[model samples]
Target: MSQAPAVLRGQVVDAETHQPIPNAQVGVADNRLGTSTNDDGRFVLAIPPAYQQARLEVALLGYRKHSQALPPLPGPELRIELRISPAALGEVQVTASVVGIVREAVARIPRNYPVRPTQLTGFYRESDNEPDGRPRYLVEGLLTVFKPGYQQRGDDGEIRIQQSRKVDLRPAGQLVRIDWAGGPFITQYGDFVHRRAQFIDLKHLRDYDYRLAPGSSYAGRPVFVVVFGPRAGNRRADFAGQMYIDQDTYAFLGAEWHYTAAGLGRSPNRADSRSLRVAYQPYAGRWHLKTVWWQTRARLPIGPPLNYFGEFLTTAIDTAQAARPDYVERAQYHDVFLRNAVAYDSAFWQGTTTLLPPESLRKALLDQQRQQRADSLFRPTTPSAAAGTAPGPAEPTQQPDNPLGRFFSRFRYGASVGAWPLAVARAELAVAYAPAGYRFGAQTTALITDQALTGWSRVEYQYELTRELTVTLATQYVFRQFSGRGWAAGLSYQHNLRPRHRPLYGRVGLAYTCQTVGRQLGTFTNPDDGLRVAGTNLGADRLSLRLQTQADALQPTLGLGLELSHKFELVADASYLLPLRTRTQLEIAEESGFFLTRSSATVDLPAADVSLRVNGQPGSTLPWRQQHWLLSVGLLYRLR
Candidate 1:
């Protein structure tokens, strides 16, 4: 058995002002294990037995780095006071031009950042809120990120969600919804240095005007502050921001940027405002991304504006053991981190150091949980049926308490009407149940036209790869009004293009279907005499021809869904089926009809052995070779 790890609790504050320092980095010297102080400037760190003798270190921007021997395990909380560095106390002089300093910093990017692969462990949190600052929901996760160093171009990196939990704070009857896309990956994409953002890109230097601002400090070192914005008459430039560079080394330390009026004008969604901040920490002779904070606000079509906020805090870094994540572990760029998150683990969260949410959000979350508990208390309970007693009055079924059970118990049913673009009008009804990451469903469709009627019943299984992607397998039975039937099997994949938090979402799908269909052809009539012709007639006008064929097709589909409320959604889908290959078989049938009785005879014939003509002209042997298009619109109701 392994020994229990030692725990250290501490608070970091300024030596001169005695004020708490938020976002301070605390760790063991030369070790990969670390944590950051919360908003209260408090931190808790766990040290393994092997590292108990190592020194504890604390560092924050504009302060002097402090280190001391580890105190006894289980001791009282320690208070650490860090003094302001002399350089940051207005003691350093800068004589270089602002533009030159920024240029040198951009040029040294490859040398300042890691040149090889590196891994970082961090905490990610995102929140959705109303315009009035009421919290709607919050998602938190532990993430492991792997990235190719700055020397490599066009490589963004990979993220693996280790664990996560979501808390919904919306009150009962709240119908509005809002969410962010790309989750923690948004922070990765926001890394200005890694992405070579326009502001820092050397090629765009002439488009911006830069001026030296007041001096600042970061990571216990003085930094040169440079403020920049788009130059006059530069309509293409859309950002205004400040950059912090280390005074001695000229290495880029941090940046804060926001969209200017010109930028907001170019936004496709007409965002009211957007801003982001990124900071880097120096360790082991290289700089690593330390923190990222982003916020955005946009007006809704029918209500107040929605606000989104997200942050990522790196707690540990490892360069020696850095490697790419396996395919199953790597998160897709469109994946919603909360949907792909692992179940919450209380013990793990208790031991982890994470940024705490604001007091208002925490209180809202608590109230939500309390309401859930209060509601649960009034749920009616039923007696066991195996007690050899008569059944009691019917009552509403209770929701399952376990996560897996609850998921399986949830269901959705929908009905829709559509058309095949002048070919056939159709109505469809569908139902589905989800047990975990996968779902099982069934749908029945009816098609009608002036000349024919058709019905299709299908059973489908779908597995969710991410919140926005799903793979489907289905088998279907098709029946026509003419006493004809067929069987089909297909595989398809669907990807949602819109964020889940939006009221409107769009998706695209691709499928391959193989099917065989048999249908009876109406009796042939001679055009010249308007007389019926029989093949092997038991009686005139009673002879029927049947056609059976195999058709394989590739289908592409586009769909949209609009949330009507918490439990209902309106959906529409359109699909085009392109036939790939077809094989035909023909048969001749003769029927004898009597009062309340009928008899039929069928003779099979090869397509090559039979000849068909229409309007005195030869007809193609492959009759079911045409492509088809289908469209449908429906309403879905969720039941749980």
Candidate 2:
């Protein structure tokens, strides 16, 4: 087998200002093998043995192209600087109408761009953050894309994910979730030349006014810079920016534009602002899309503004080897790329030739991964030695020395307000502790309402299936002023939906609950005598009664959480209980002037028809064994 290619690392900067030049084209001269500098003007390229003697070229629009012989294998990092081209400084004058120049460039697209299919292998990255600069979601991947030539307008192209990793930082419990659905495919849609953006569309050319800006140089060729914007009173115009067109061939080199204020106002995505950049490189005598960068801020009605950034760089391109991706491998237009992320592969990232992410982003990604590992309930444990052999030294436990300190470190505290129908409202306090893959918790709740005094207490256990999912089992005891005492048991599944807002998370849960309603005894008035009475007696001056019930139900829950600080989160949840089975009983304790009747028979009743008598008169039906809804809002505090 042949040896692996030698790696080349370098940075490019302006020759005069010494400032780094981002997105500069860097590659082997005349070869399709190339890559672009990242935002920091840094790059990593692999040079095969065959290209050891070949020259490397670095070019950027407005900058004179730089070329030099390849450095020796395992050489020091290369630092190259490019000077501004004289032609770009307006040393050469242009006398043509800028509109005609732009028009000609648009007309030359069929000849300037490829007419046959091509394949691209590249790196893609997309990230979004909250208004305060907190990271929300990030996904980066290596991709294989199949592109139908510019002549074909209907084919949007296809992309296949090769390797990917994602980080989701949205905490659980959020009311609003934002998702950027298209992922890297957004780059394809941003290809204004092939997609015929309104500004470049031949039929819509008359709606815009174009003016010649300063001249420029791209890929060593002098180019004309034409700036265009909506004409006065043109309500349909949406974009304003500048385009680079080759002065000699009229081939469009690149363009940078942003949505106008009016366009932003009418945006369906509620965009606060949006901008895009698209560039092309001449390959084998035809121009091919080289890079796409897009950024946008969305002003949602709820929560802070969300910012998004997407970048696509063409690392290598192939026409001869181009082929369509398999149907199953193709990414759907509406697919959420995060759902397709695979396990993080350190090896692939280490060896791949891709654009380097910004230092801050890299640090954030690492910190997020570290935090996840720290918060994970399950951790790898050392295996025991074989049966016949003595055990090796026990692996050191990475924990605090004090047992009590370690024990208390696992606890979390929270408080919430809960509500149900029938004027019942409650305040709940809870505590939880997780020492391993499972958690144990308890809650105490006190109800305050006009009709009754009540309290509930519950103990629960939760087993984590993953970072974002859990299985829960709980049991509770309920006590009411007039309704007596009861107990319930339930099992549930909960999932966290990671939203784009860093401080918020949305949760969904389903549970099955089994409960028993104990005896409920209270005094009531006899309608005929105007005297206090209880228990099914309509004529007695005073009477007493008892009620009992049992029920099984399916409960569906939706919850939202908002982060208040590092140690606290505000959470709210709503749930509806649908009954599956119910059994009820009503017993008259005193009736017809009889008191403390020891031989009285209990009366069985249909749960739907049983109504409790209150204040010596008929009242609303008993809540036992009936469909109902629960709502709760609270704040959770982390103990450690």
Candidate 3:
């Protein structure tokens, strides 16, 4: 048959420096046949049995280029030299998946590998030759998100728009602030999304372990090849593809990630094997993504897209009282300050950023209830309906895990729409009930601890006008599974909070039903309408005041709330909602006076962009609660 080839020889060099790149990429491509270069950047591979003409490739990250072809018979003591180069030039080659270059040149991997490979770094080592030519750089770009209606997790993963600030580098390797004032960025910051300054030089990765993977190469030079494995805290993460570094100067031609998070038009993922290819131009000293084609599969969390489901607060001001009445409103604050999307209001309590008191509110309300049971002294922190301080007196029947609000809670005004139909959108949950089934004179429906799960909810828009709670009109649209389409409208008054924490604050709304309750034909049908109008019965009008509060004691998890509702007809109101929990309620009216009623325990699947709540009817139509009760638990990740 065939005998193993004899003399084996190869040239080795630095993958970056390109000049006699050395000291790496020894033996065979895999665990097959391989050898490293000597001090002279050269290696001899005495072919083992059964191999043909082959050469060894010397490689390393942020170093000189690697030469693999072999010349005639180069005896042992092969010569090989490695040229060191700067890391983080205009381009950086890497992989989205936890990268691992297992050769002796590289080591291990970490956890939570990157989901997307949009991360880039730049290394600036004063090129003593010419300096001023690299001051102002330009990076034109385009980013497309997943289809508007992808089946997988979307809305929360929409394509994002950004214009990031360019960072400046000092050869001394010192921390330097960027020109923050001149970003003129196209993107805004928020709890849900935003961008960062582009400049984390790779120079640091040089003496580090891992080496490049086999079938991978760099798109640009000095920045040519990059080697990496899982970092410290990146296990259990998905691995993408390898990045190609340029064989010349350290610069970025672009990236080649295994998974692409962006898409074209509304097309779902066309391929499971994602790849992100980019086109960049070198500006002053920076490189930007000019054109990028990001591809990935559907049903995955991949984006920074047009997110439309966060929440905010609003207030109604009575300008008649203040000399300078500002109908001021706040939109997407998550872009600037995450977790601080509290809607703006017009009342005294508006504009103040406050942390949720997970414990105090509950204690205060419970203490009041004990006093009422003692038949002892009477306390009046606030008047019942006197209009002075809303938190008049401690409520005797304060609810634990309640959503209707403690004693007194008032809200400013401004959910109303101006130019756009959306005044404020958010993720929420809610529950409804009928006690005595009447709006005005009916008794509220809420029992001990009972709740139902509805997905994220929406709150309607309101505007500030007067000083008192009497604003001309308060309109709101709530997204629910109502008759016909899955939405309802509501209109109501401006409610306020007395500064109590238990179920912090809520809203009081009213809805004039236009049509009667109908059915939802979907396989997973939820409640379409609560009112199945009896024949000849005029459509019913609803009235409610719901309260929902966050429990700081359980930060980063768990949400709680309560609701109190009434229908004008008295016998048509019910209220009690707990997600993945039980709901017990009781209804009362001017006629029946009071009575225990419907009770239901169910699971609540969170919704997309609306706040869930139990509040006064909105739009004179069925509406969503202003405060969200749609609590949920899950993991969060970005697709950038």
Candidate 4:
């Protein structure tokens, strides 16, 4: 049996002014356990006994990260203070020496980054600005990124769409076309840490010449500024830019880069260029991408000049809980297409605050609604009519679908509402309405939240008994692409428990569930379009359970569950929230379960198969087992 874990408590503060730093990251260097400081810069982390000898790390943006061996035993009240980093890199601002510093920083990536899955919830915005600085098209979105351990690479990190909004204000009769692919994902693709290594990797360093210069201070920290570009004799289309690394941890802090005309895919004769700026901040002992700004311009031979500018800002980071490896099935971000996903009403917007003001957001949405309405009303019914009438605003030409288009289009919708989550490979829809605190709706289980729709068709009903209590019943049909499709139903009663502190609350509930698993559970390479299939889990299931929890915005939630069965399961999860500002709160949660008796099986995905090793033996099968184990970090937002 595993020994109980030890608890470490402390407060992270600024050294000079001695103020608490809210949302500062605190963790043990070698374990999956970690947590962030609350508003008071205080934190409590459950450290596994295995990492008793490891160091504890504390970090916040603009400040030097702090690390020290854990106390021999949980000690007295601890206060970890971080100094504001000096904004200079000593006298080593020389060229040859600067390259060495860059090399060292790159080498330290593995040691400084999180080895476990980490989730970050941030705000992202993209805009097309007119020459006068007015935004022609604006989009804002909340992002939940499941960062793979530092050992991963590329867009390997899973990105989930939380909530988003967009507004297009092109002149009624004119259209401004800018590629969405390059709008924001450029930042993801341009990740200086895990990817975009060509800028710093030793193997790729030969392509560019390096220079060193003094850089301005960032978040009050001094940095070593290094500039590099394609060698004079080597004129390949490439990026030329300056990069800054914190002098202390050797972490990449910020960069100013420009794409050459050739790099923009324009001919030498065409005047084209794009300037981009990217910045990072130290969070919880790791550097995170914080902001990206860029502007692109071109002189097209056939049409009016093209100009576009965009910016992406990250608002929060939740390091307390890591996200499930499959937090979001990556393909869904593409399959359903963000543009055609979900739509929310003004209530949603009113309930959430973003980097932009509520009034500004309202105007943007209103303008888009008006423009869409006008286009629909003015659109000619026939091609002949379109030609006969004076030309209306030039319709946006349909371009070949590209990954970038789908990514940006995602900013237009809300999280999926119906059939998208379950079927894992099929499209689904849902319809519902509620009146007087009661609701009736039909939705597919397959496509509910972030995963593929479960294809479990269901009709649901809910009745509010009071402000804090409600009762719900749902009957669902499970349809598998292969077999094992059946029916299941559940009824649950829950009561919300509130503490005097407004931001804190909890829930208690009771539920009964019944399910039937067909004899042949089919597995397909691609549920939507796979040609191969196999049978798997087979059984009938029933359960009765009771649950209780108490939590609030600023405190970690504590929950307990009891399953009423011969062999039952026990589950527990905890979370804490940190308010970054007026309407934004970052939440992180983790869950683990213990089952006296559980089902086990091995499933294969010919299309998405993964290899594994068991007890030091290489294995080709993924054993599906139920017992007690740690869950990935979950990030949630309380934005109003």
Candidate 5:
């Protein structure tokens, strides 16, 4: 049986300007099925029979929301005029200079933003397109984001993916798949408003130079347009764009920015270009994120370009906690990758509001299957080793076997040459393998000295107990010509914190240590005994617990770490390591003046003060006097 949908026609326009407001959202209040207006501010909503009598809501970012009762059946166009929100009209004086307006906005964030807890329901989408802008992959998710409070230093919000779908459209022989797994996750962290100071803090005002453009209107509200770019003396400022600010409230209405020339050098992640546009609106006396759109184009060293686009739109807001936080927590969500998102009944998405049209989605899926079939016929079933052919490019969203990859990608090889405390020059080499939650790795270091190589080699293995926990076992052997020859073994558990700006971690450990100390000339247990033991080294054993954490994201210039041990004391350390410059070298040469050529490349060399450490440990020595500070600098070059 089929029921005819009730057609709701409407035109959304600015109340004062009488101009069409494009892309305004319109739908039945409280329902997921909704539609957006076109460039002409015209919308046609086909409401189901169940919602025919419901109220139709029209909303735009900067304008006041409007609602009206729907007719019983299909109706003629109902005109909707949205006025500039009264909340946006404030007593704040207008500033002719863009810099002044931006400064005021940054200063007023704590005041104008929501102070109490709030929850938001929104739709998120990630799409991939061919060079010609043909859609190839799409994933849509309905998510609930819970914010602790605006005044909080760190965002305690949680993003629960309520429902989601992953559509694959690559051809069979096409080993390349769109990077879709972490798209949603990236968008979640892309909430720059929550991380107030990270992108545009008052302290970083010097990084950007602002210019005031002519005033304009957005959603019927008067706006001051500010054009910004890197400051004359600052090369690190990598963003250039314009920001629209509400004239009366000094609040940000919208902004669009793209990577500048300097930014391209910092990102060697194949991101040739990147841009984002964001908008905010006042809802119930508190400002809220209305929309976020991010686009990027990645070009590999030897492949066609891959384009990625992601968007998030807030459809509803609940300041009173109407919806329970029953969904999965950040830890649980972090453990699951979006690439593994399960498919659901078509009825699932049919009930939800989405940006991608159904017809377009189906066509993309069919195209993927068609391309896969064509590729399967040409691609060899097995990989070739004799031909020295490298494997195809790994999918960007592919998950590592280790569950930790859910939080961050794992590294395979790394090397660092820096100075160690008491050692003028030292270098380290690390090779690790972590798959399926089992980890094995070895690290060795050598201290360059006048005598000989002196350092330690450590081998470790980790067994993932769960998504947030891991069991680790390790052993270390120290090598020194005239120093203590010893070995240490330990067992520990590491837990990674979740849903926060700064990476946090805690570990509880137990260890047994032994060191062969030089023996005294004579040693005897019994004073009166005529026997004495001599020329033998003494061995020592001990057990201890250690807890440590690093907070770098919160304060880039200064980082604090603390380590405590049951063996008797606490060790506190502070460090500052900032990169001065990042350099890259590319070289090309002809091999025997023929088609075959020998090649090598080095990508980045970041110079930083890698050895800046100030530590205080009262329980470290009997005399309570030891070296507590060390500073050194080094340059690290990549080799592959």
Candidate 6:
């Protein structure tokens, strides 16, 4: 016999106080029939005679909920009670019965396959209390979604996601975001899996032991309750909250997660401490997530004071349906908030990307792993004995002897001057004596010749020479007038970690300069000479030794960057007045860009000590004059 039609009526009441609860939700499991409890906590439900025997769910904000099978009846007026309780996260259960099903399902998924969730939009409703205790309102919403190339933390995208104080929200229209990264919007693809980068691990569902509990209802409809647990070995994946799954399918019916503190290797790091709920339904052979509710509860001074709550929902339907797949909204709602004795309701679709989690800040991980092979490992792997050519078995471990001895092997150098410490300027020359054993790189430098502040710089290029170190021999020419030609050169044993700039380094060198009395000032040459000049033109000749220090991003691949350098130059040069003494210059003549693009700003600091000797007189002219200070700014720009 067919069951009779029945109208089940009820009043929604807070289970604890038995007080009427307004705007509470009552619905059938996975079905579209649902209603919000009015101000009176009263609701009227019409049950079709054919649709009897379904599950009913009663939900309200800040409350414990209830789910039960429905019975046919216009029966007694029923009363649904919702109890308020602190949210207790459920534990995960992994056993023998359900692991296989999830494993099989996972194996069936293609790598990098964009799930349908990638295509759907998410919308939410929220209400918040204003700082002044005024009621706030946000209602009905829509969201549009898309796949975005995740980059750093900045929010520049098609659309963003949001949630409000209300207890529920679903997918609406226009904008949506999905990020697999630890931050908001789980949009990252599967390639991010296994990388020791961000902490969110969306790829380990099967490995994490996701499944329904043993006592769940398992009829042909196969209703079951499942929980999700984290995998060992890895520490955190946003510590996402627990999830409730449909026993019959791995589809998530509900989920609760809170973000944690900053991940390891992160700057100004922080974790997510907010709670969230996600719900899904099966449609057309695919699972469509329907709603998501997130409640923000962060710890003091650091966290947001007001507990934030937001809901999101979505729906897909036939062209002729009121909620058309494109035209009609299958979901509509508003943000709910009641605080400081006031309540506000407004639309949640208008969310700002301000608080959203950072997107793909790990470009380095996606970059193909490139480990430089040791010379031995690589060269040895190449057939050391080619057919017809016995390459002596290739002894890659040995360095070709520099037979040149100490004069060459014992000498190393480098020089630089930049914008910190003093706008007054700087310059340096580093020198190192290798076979000589002692490791200090001596320096001689100068800065601000235009301002009358003479200087000298020196340094030793030898520091920590190891298996992984590269050295550079740098030569710089400061102010050089045939009347006073002064040039400097440095030999530095630089260790290059990056093909570009080195953050940490050392230098040393023996430098010499001689300024003559050719009568006229000469070309100032490149950057190093424009500010400070150190030649033996001063009343006294000098020999100096010094050091270096720095920090910056190094792109060993791109082979490009700017370095901030500081140098102590120890001057070493007695003026060379010999006729064979040479002074030359590389001139652009007119087109300066011939050597540098518009993006580069290279300033050559002019420097030279004037010890005049009017034909052997002790005036400021002949002996090499070494500048005590020099500030030269080197700017480089790359069009590519």
Residue-pair clashes per prediction, in order, are: 1, 13, 175, 31, 8, 148
Q: Please state every model's RMSD to the true fold in angstroms.
A: 21.3, 21.9, 25.7, 25.7, 22.9, 27.3
- How would you order the candidates by lDDT, starting with the best? 2, 1, 5, 4, 6, 3
Per-residue lDDT tens digits of candidate 4, residues 1-640?
3587777778888898999977555667532345567778888877778888888876544456677998855666689998875633432223343455566677778776665667765655565555565655555556666666666764456565566555555644333243343243544655667674567877767677776555545668855567788877765636788888765566778888887645666434244777878777678777777776666776655455556655556656667657453422331322222242334333454355555565644443335664354345333255655679654332332324455433332221011112212112222222111112212111111221223323334443444444344454544344443112222122223232322211222434433433222212112121111111123221213111111011111222244322211112132323223322211111111111235342233222111222223233444322211111112111111110
User: Candidate 2: TM-score?
Assistant: 0.44
lDDT (CA) per prediction? 0.63, 0.64, 0.27, 0.47, 0.49, 0.34
lDDT tens readout by residue for model 1, 54-106 = 89877654566788999988789999998987656442222224555666677
Alpha carbon lDDT of residue 296, candidate 5?
A: 88
- Candidate order by decreasing TM-score: 1, 5, 2, 4, 6, 3
Spell out the clash pairs found in candidate 5: 169-368, 171-371, 171-372, 172-371, 172-372, 173-375, 173-376, 401-436
Model 6 — TM-score against the truth?
0.30
Q: Candidate 4 at 384: error in angstroms?
A: 44
**In angstroms, how far off is 194's CA in candidate 2?**
0.8
TM-score of each: 0.48, 0.44, 0.24, 0.40, 0.45, 0.30
Worst 10 residues of 3 by lDDT: 565-574
Q: How would you encode candidate 2's per-residue C-alpha lDDT over 176-204 as one tens digit per residue? A: 45667777796578888888888888777
Best by lDDT: 2
Q: Please report the TM-score between candidate 1 and the true structure.
A: 0.48
lDDT of 3 by residue, 150-226 (tens): 11112322222221111122233222212111011112111001121111113323222333443334333333244
Residue ranges of candidate 4 with Cα displaced over 4 Å: 1-93, 130-135, 171-179, 182-184, 266-271, 298-302, 324-340, 345-347, 354-640
Question: What C-alpha lDDT does candidate 6 achieve relative to the native structure?
Answer: 0.34
